[model samples]
Target: MSFHEGGPRAAQQKDTRSPGTGAGTVALFTLATIMCLLALAATYYFFVRTTTGQFIDESALVRADTIRGRAGRASTEFLDWLPVTSLVIAAVVVLFVTIVRRRWTAAGIAVAACMLANLATQLLKDWLPVRPYRGVQTLELNSLPSGHTTLAASAAAAVFLMVSPRWRPLAGFLGGTFAVASGVSTLINQWHRPADVIAAFLVVAAVMLPAGWLVLRTGKDWNAWDGDGGHWASSRFWVLLPGIAVVVSAAVAAYALRELILGMEVTDSTSSYFWAGAAMIVGTGHFAMVAAVWLFSWAARRRGPARR
Candidate 1:
């Protein structure tokens, strides 16, 4: 008797993934989330509680005045534009990707994470204690995890989540640049200190890492793609370039710190401290983006055909 082989064969082919498909992804993301939280706490402890940290932070703010000019006005304009820009990025990217790819669950998770990150920032701002007397002249108010920086970074992360793995590297890099620029703009405008911006980066990372893990798990079909070089956006350069930026910025920041430590005759009007703060923001934002790219790439399955 001839038997039709289509039914069982099709069923077998329907699912090739094992039960423990994304366990490693989950564990890695959990560890990353913990790291982000710990980094945020350390930021607060160092920049808010310690005397030397307070001095460095306040010095950056003071040095900001020395750069006030056309550049400052440009930064002010960018700051004014930040809220609208953030909303537009999230709304447009999420809606377009969702409608096109029909990624309803991914979109929902991303939007939710973005909102949660922003809300968490506001809550932290209000609930955190006032900067206590650390024997350094500085603002007494609490401004950890800057509101604008949180909004910008989380919005970028939302876009990163909506895109397929093939496009994530490019998206992550561009989004990182935008977030870093927003953070630096806040500093250039003297609206928030460097620590606040870095804290915002950590907050977005902590919130989005789990959301990314969920995306990889649920959207496994779309998440899998050919390994890097399949597309220009998927190229390793996207990650490597950001890593290079982190290294260069770190070096600049280190030089600035060394100068300060050696008791160099650096005046308040000098731009060294401001540059150092900007470098720190650039390094931190890009580092977070790079980490996200690496973590998601690791979790996402490679060399798989799209499953219906």
Candidate 2:
């Protein structure tokens, strides 16, 4: 066959091989799902079951009390606004995309998974045993998998799911920032421990990863797009910003921890623990979103000439 004729045929063959249907994609997503679950379990065990972990967790909450003048009220207000904000944003984005692109099945799956993530958070909160007394003078109530964080993250995940691949990096970064802000607000408001916020992230990842796999499988045609930098939203800035945030947040947390271990006075309204917990929240949330961006970017089809 002539080179021109063979080119079109080869392109047709490549297009038929949907991006997310490969064995490698399945293994990667499955590994991610399992990792989230294990992380959730580990967060619960360390924070709720161990003495040192409980001490640090409770200390962070206690330190948050020192900064309760203006920041606390603002955080409380933000938490109060979270439900309405999440619902409106999720509904608007999902509906607009579904209508614009006629992505009915993908939208349905995203919305359903979003709901399930939220419900699972509530169930885990109730079903998980109360925090064991590990010589920490704290409340006995069970607050793992923060409800507010779950709502925010799941809503963000829904929006992330509905957008085309070119828009996902931007969407993921923004969504992750929203989730991190919600988690930090909960901490500043003294509503949950760091582990609770972290668990919520895991819960969202656990549910959304599988839902995303289904999205790729069902919406193969619509998922194709030029690789990163082909559009403004697909630029590397989105991923880079989050990666930088993760690094900065990790440094902050490490410094705070080192101060604590070196016998520095951290309990005299220093708020060091609070800052560390907030950093943890920011780092975990951004890392999760970054992973989502990378995963879906790999899974989505890039329209290009077929490889020889």
Candidate 3:
């Protein structure tokens, strides 16, 4: 209907995503999802399947063995509670926000995304062939995408999706941090390899990106936002902290794992370098995702002041 016949209320309900920006957003999200899936493939192939990969993968377990004591037990105990606790908290928070905002479609999209991510993890784990015994000491079963890490990351992503764009950067940072910490905790506890944690994150990204686009498309008014104001708390600090985290962690990981690249016949399982490298992967993956999603939202932002 024309604007006049459609009336004020009808016009008010118009989509916030403009046609020009909508196409771009769709393209960006599609590419991001594909890239994440590709990265996931590379991680599984290079870090989980090969003989060299198994050697590197089991290195962290060597460190975990050394640290087996009260500290290790305590860490495992905490992580045991993390998956359920984080999801419950994320669900409650997201549900409250979605209800208050009354964005029913957005809520559905977020929940569906979370469920699909977790389900995909389990399905992939069961369907993938068992890891070949490449003379590695690690378990032979397929453990690509970790169930715990998938649950944690998807929970956080759900919360990140439900928040307003103005608040999303900060929320994304916090959510991603929680997810990364959960992944690292699994490593420190010896429950999963770094590749498992990394794969879980990639799976969450693949599922959530397209779901996020749907949320934006259906709840356009709620998703729209203005450019970041001069407030440090708003956007600058959110992106800055994660940026620095990714940089520092990358440097440390590169330095710590340089021997692997040098072809030195070192297979020490008790090396702290393994844990450091795993933590670095977790940090880099989660933070980079936060920045990417935030940049997309910022690009699609409305130019004028936020709607009243």
Best by TM-score: 2
Residue range with the least summed lDDT across 10 consecutive positions in model 3: 299-308
The candidate scoring highest on lDDT is: 2
In candidate 3, list every pair of residues with a backbone clash: none
Q: CA lDDT, every prediction?
A: 0.86, 0.88, 0.74
Pairs with steric clashes in candidate 2: none
Query: How do the predictions measure up, each by TM-score?
Result: 0.91, 0.93, 0.88
Compared with the true structure, the alpha-carbon lDDT of candidate 3 equals 0.74
Model 2 TM-score on a 0 to 1 scale: 0.93
TM-score of candidate 1 on Cα atoms, chains taken together: 0.91
lDDT string for model 2 (118-149, tens) is 99999998999998888899998999999999
Candidate 3 residue spans exceeding 4 A from truth: 1-21, 68-71, 230-233, 267-270
For all predictions, the C-alpha RMSD in Å is 3.8, 2.9, 4.5
List the candidate 1 regions with Cα displacement exceeding 4 Å. Answer: 1-15, 18-20, 260-269, 302-308
